[model samples]
Target: MAADIRQLLLAAFEVEHHEHIAAIRGALGSATPDWNDVFRRAHSLKGAARAVDLPAVEAVAHRLETLFERVRNGASALDRDGANAVHLALDRIESYVAGLKDGAGPDMPGDALAALGRYLGLHGLAPEASAPPAASRAPVAAPVAAAPAPKAPPEPAESGAAILRVPGEAVEALARASHDLASTLAAQAPAAEGLARLARLARDLRAGAEVLAAGAETERPELRAFAARLGSFAREAAELSRRQGAATSAIEAAAVRVHAGAERLALVPAETVLGPLARSIRETAREQGREVDLDLQGLDLPVERGTLQALKDPLLHALRNALSHGWQQPELRRAAGKPEALGLGLEVAVRGSRLQVTVSDDGPGPDLTRIEAAARARGLLAPEGPADSETLLRLVFEPGFSTAEAVDTLSGRGYGLSVAADAARQLLGSVRLEPREPAGTALVFSLPLSAARRSLLLVEAGGRTYALPGGVVERLLRLERAGLPLAMGRTILRHGAGDAATSHPVTDLAEILGPVSAAPDPGNPGGAPPDPGILTAVLLRAGGGRLALAVDRLHDVRSLLVLPAPSFGSDPGLVAGTAVLPGDVPVLVLDPEGLAARAAVTSAVVSAGTMAQAPRSTTASRATARATILVVDDSITTRTLEKGILEAAGYRVVVCVDGQDALDRLRAEIEPVDLVLADVEMPRLDGFGLLKALRADGRFARLPTILMTSRGDAEDVARGLDLGADAYLTKQKFDQRQLLDTIGQLL
Candidate 1:
């Protein structure tokens, strides 16, 4: 009976989880919520808890429901007290659910039970009301508040969005199971069967990731990629098992690592708390005569457990402080050479391995005079000591310290800065205060890429095989392990096979996947750490660009359909699909074209201003003397816009309809084209195939070419550049100036 009850309780948790999310959404609807909607949700939660025999959960929910019922019927109005009651009840329910998971047997705290009883008394409901009769409510879908509210209402479930929010507790449990699987797999010896099993698990894990991102926007490409990854990994695992021996160990390891990453990718939206935070901030700010403009960047950011929870209060408090104290009166601000209405800006960006959040305001910054006086009075500084701006600013974070003349009713309690500091520290993050370039101050908080796997090779580093597409690979080469040259700025390995000699770059092992173990063989000699010359290099086409990735082993190449990468911005990772090789181990197919586009956006060696900038030398004057460089992009607007830039800078620019037409023009043209600027991600014959076709033919092999597209990553760029591409550029990072500069350099 006890076991049955526990199982039922878990089921109830899954049911009520939807209600918790719905209740919050109902309260904060775009329009002032009709009180009945709020009451109905709370009432439903109470009845569900009661049916599950979780009396504590039922009792608290019951009291809160009645409290809202009173407000709905005009017996009591929505007030701060009512809101607090609701907040406490919700917090308690969450805590109880967490406890149940921790073996606390669905028990609620005594103080919380007492508090709920008090709340019921305030609502005039009998404390002993015999546990309100069970009320059945069909599962209310998890609220999709991120979607735009309709004018009236859409026909049921017709909302275009597809993501559904699952309870966090359930997700955490799944995550734990995934971790256990990883540990179990890691403990086994590296074998074909083991690698194959691990690869199938990776596919399943990717399916779980899709469920995680489910009910989010259907337009999110990553979700679809996740679904595709699962199928690919499953197939790949089967293939890995078919192969035998130690030579296949790396492939097996790669599959396992990829599955591990897919599990982490099953992350929920961390900014879920922001919806509540915004409401609280709005209400609190109204009490103080301040008008705040709230701006949030990266709302789609996915975060794991601790990092998401840790950010809740600190970010909220910082915004509240900005509203209550940071801004001056509109007229005063206008007179003092600032905008009348102050702006509160919150920006979140992922820079490499860090999540950077900057919150800033344009207000009287610290009132330097007051800070100096406070420092003097507190003996924090010598009477005539060196109290610089930075030194004085440091005092704000001190406990029980503030520059405000007197404690304010809303703020100036001196705990805001300390609270913010503590919250950042708890997340393995840091916070800083520095004056924005000109006026006011900016609070920048940095959080690490908590879910990112740490390793040298992204492919093999995590002991997993990522799928690489057939179309992306130009050729695979085995290098001599010894006597590699470090000239030409890249790791170049030289080898002699009969009369033929080959030289290759020793790229960062981590850049390709991670640090890889040596491929055992006597035919290859050994070199330095980065210059493990005997490694296999796969030249790939990413985002219609090029890259040459060095891998420790070369497994069989098979087709794995496209999967979306776990993306932060426009730049996805080096993956496109997941395929099973001969061993049934899953290998993530790298999209060299997509990767190249991303790399083109991020490559520091290529200037952002230069990649998209127009060329200065024109072919009109030297039409007979020089070869024309054609720029082919899909958008007529982009083509027209680019033509103007190229024309202005004196280049003979021929605008082609698409890659296919460009190829046709190249083949049948009378004049020799000096270079080609083509978009990679276009319909028909993409830039990658065009490059390959051109390289395969003798006519265009030596023709300088620059591939332009939106997809960019180091591997993609390397693949393109390695395949004889003169330049690889992404439209996202390269402006007209950058494009022109790249063209000039290539020319």
Candidate 2:
């Protein structure tokens, strides 16, 4: 019986206890208090506390119950002191409950209990007698007159209709089953298409048979019989096609229902997490002696449970930053002609197939001057020129980068935005700072609705199938060979006509991913064309620029179930994941942002190399005729800075974001490149890989190369030089003159 009571107390008592405390607090300073209702709630809490053998909790509740009973019986009047005492008692009870929940023995501050007793005595009420020795009476960091028995085991929290706690494993299992079913259904699509083709052929056959029957004479028995047989076969084929079509439709509907149900089960309403978030903001504001109004929109929007869990910390960090940094003091706001209480708003909505959540605060936007100053101090900005808005904004997300003058508990350490950005990346989402109109700043997070399932455009490149997320692709084009122009030793495509015409850098997908021995073009009759080839470009919108990826062929669009790549030490950044296509064919899903960055760097590097060998004649020389050099690095800022410095020195510069891209460009270049300057550590492939590839190739074996990287350890330098590098330089010791002299000597 004691064990049963303990379970009940743990499961349901805490919730009831919290409600009672809230009621007591709410009734404070009221014109008329509900004495009878308060008495009943206190009585119930006291009984549950006694059953659980928590003497400290029961004592506080018992005192409250007695006082409220007096008020209900009209023996005592509720006064301000009485309200104060009740609040104190409730606070003490909450502390004990917290201790028990922490697996510490049920305990409370003895002084607080004594204070409550003294207050009751002044009201002409006698204090309740202490509990018997059998009850738990653990001391809270102090010795007591008598101690009770050992504490009982803690039980699970009570279940409620308002919230459900589902096991993570169960959710994962359901997701896998759904994905498998979808894959199977996708495989059946081709068979349905085949049925349609068969039906068309059957109709054509019947038409031919009718013509033959009309032409045939009755005297020719064999010809008539042949025509009749053909007509019968055509009718049978048509009937079979009709039945298959209906069955296919039914199967498709069932698959859609299953997929929809599974996705819904894996998601929860956005409001599920927003309630606690709002409470946290209010409590933090109260602590800081500030007034804030937080409004949440689209609370009913559904988001994946995993995504919500990942976003919890990031959202908390954002809120803290908004309160501590984005909002102005109440008095300051009034002086600035704004509302006394700052407004912080969070709006979540489904945009197309993605979920976008924006957090905005009505305060002065971030100071660009301060951010630029910080970037300069951290050596992240160019000294001669002012940083762009995008560059300055990106500085806020850098680790240990802050504009605050001093450190504090809230945000000065500079980990908030960095952590938020990192979390977004891990979830395959992006976070950006948007400029709000008039004033304030908005942080936007865009994430896939279902990370596992996504709409992908399948294409064939290098004789291999790869999937590109449909969201990033702008358009597909088959441009004439004559329209492609060679600029700075790279191919450029002119898109649109008339006023909207714009030129974009074009890269062959086969060159970026690796070469597949040129296969015969099925579309072309004879063989591979000479000189210029017809370009099939996939225009992509990445960052603030447009990139065109030239692929061999384009296939159908499909909604694929993307699975995580196996952890066998392969490059996962370039290949986001893998998906099983129709006919059980597996295809790699490409990360477009990474690909675009690589393409930009590659084009820059190739241009640099081409300029190095250019003729000096002003009339005869083109931009590609100058001394060309290739600069490779993963950081866009670093790559841009290097390109600027080299280009300013009269050298044509091309940049590659990583080693793999550099190697690909080197292999695909028709003209010889003069030099290769690359960073040491990068994704997909590193500097050593590039150097090794260059040395192994007969054409580039004697090409001048320099390694510039942040890894400046003696052993690293030695390793790079040993791998056939002409010179190895550390970024910490980088100098424009020194780099130029090294390249000149090597060339």
Which residue runs does candidate 1 get wrong by more than 4 Å? 1-266, 336-340, 450-506, 509-533, 536-747
Positional deviation of residue 269's Cα in model 1 after best superposition, in angstroms:
2.6
lDDT of 1 by residue, 170-246 (tens): 54455444434433333343343456658768877877877767767656677778778777877777666655434
TM-score of each: 0.42, 0.40
- Worst 10-residue lDDT window for candidate 1 reads 150-159
Candidate 1: residue 118 Cα off by (Å): 35
Per-model CA lDDT versus the true structure: 0.56, 0.67
CA displacement after TM-score superposition, residue 368 of candidate 1 (Å): 1.9
lDDT tens string, model 2, 599-682? Answer: 765654442211122223443333333688888899999999989887886778888889999889889994457888898889
